[model samples]
Target: MAARKRKQSPQHEDQREKVRFYPAWCKRCGNCAAFCPQHVIEMDQWGYPHAVRTHDCISCHMCEKLCPDFAVTVGEETPSSVSRRGAAGPSPGTEGSLVSQDHSPERLAKTPHPDEEEHD
Candidate 1:
């Protein structure tokens, strides 16, 4: 008999999904890059965060929850969020839902977004 190739299970398939990052919201903070236990995240010239090697991600959510600007939202992409593409939401370049009025721009600018261009 010929040897058969083993099929990958659903659990294994789920593990292969790539991690997505929101670049617009990122403030160039290196928190995600510094905190990644798997070292999956990396910073660009602008200091913004990017997922260089998603396969190494452990789904720790440290990048998402720790993000002060809510710029890094880590989660399984659901059909609902995708379906509502046109839904009204916060504007780009502004701290909409992720921060409160009490938070100042100086503070936000100081904190780097996982996916943001370097700013002075």
Candidate 2:
């Protein structure tokens, strides 16, 4: 007897805005992939979770809420909230690092440092 093959669903863009995974923060617990309602996440060969079908995402936040290591995040990036890759606010793996607002041009401005000695 042969195993029956499941039919693949048509892919369409959904409500999810962005999906990022911090491999450094992933402990390979597999909760994120296992809990995805849409089955959009998959485990890599090394056991890290990755988005297989981002368009299928429903923005349900099940993966984010279930991640014990905080390795997964699901949020929409508006025009005002857009940031360059690796330059957004705090991410899962970054600890003790200063995070500015999104990568807006204004966010690049040099602000006065509280610890810096003021010049007369």
Candidate 3:
């Protein structure tokens, strides 16, 4: 007897991807494919890793964190965020989370330098 195959809708099968791999920076180390908890990634014959079952990705960031070349990224980049990828500033909704307000200009200006302290 043949096993029954589950029917999946086109929309369901085409789930939005939560992980991305940069081909240029990838060294084909296979760490991302090995470390993926859901087996969402697979290695090609040429030792390159690619997402096989992207629908199963849980956005756990395991692949991204394990990649030695930093070739993997596990989030959708909004237009605004893409332009500010490396900008130094507080992310959205984290404005008041800092206990010491370290990023605030006023706090930084008032903070004393350790080297400038009195010797006595």
Best TM-score among the predictions, by candidate number: 3
lDDT of 2 by residue, 14-85 (tens): 433367664445577999899887788888665757787776677899999999976677876543334333
Return the clash pairs for model 3, or none. Answer: none
Q: Estimate the TM-score for candidate 2.
A: 0.53
TM-score of 1: 0.51
* Cα distance off (Å), candidate 1, residue 24: 2.0
Identify the runs in model 2 with alpha carbons over 4 angstroms from their true place: 1-17, 77-120
lDDT per residue, candidate 1, 2-24, as tens digits? 11233445564565334455544
In model 3, which runs have C-alpha deviations exceeding 4 angstroms?
Answer: 1-16, 78-120
Q: Compute the lDDT of residue 18 as modeled in candidate 3.
A: 56
* C-alpha-based local distance difference test score of model 1: 0.55
Worst 10 residues of 3 by lDDT: 84-93
What's the C-alpha lDDT at position 68 in model 2? 93
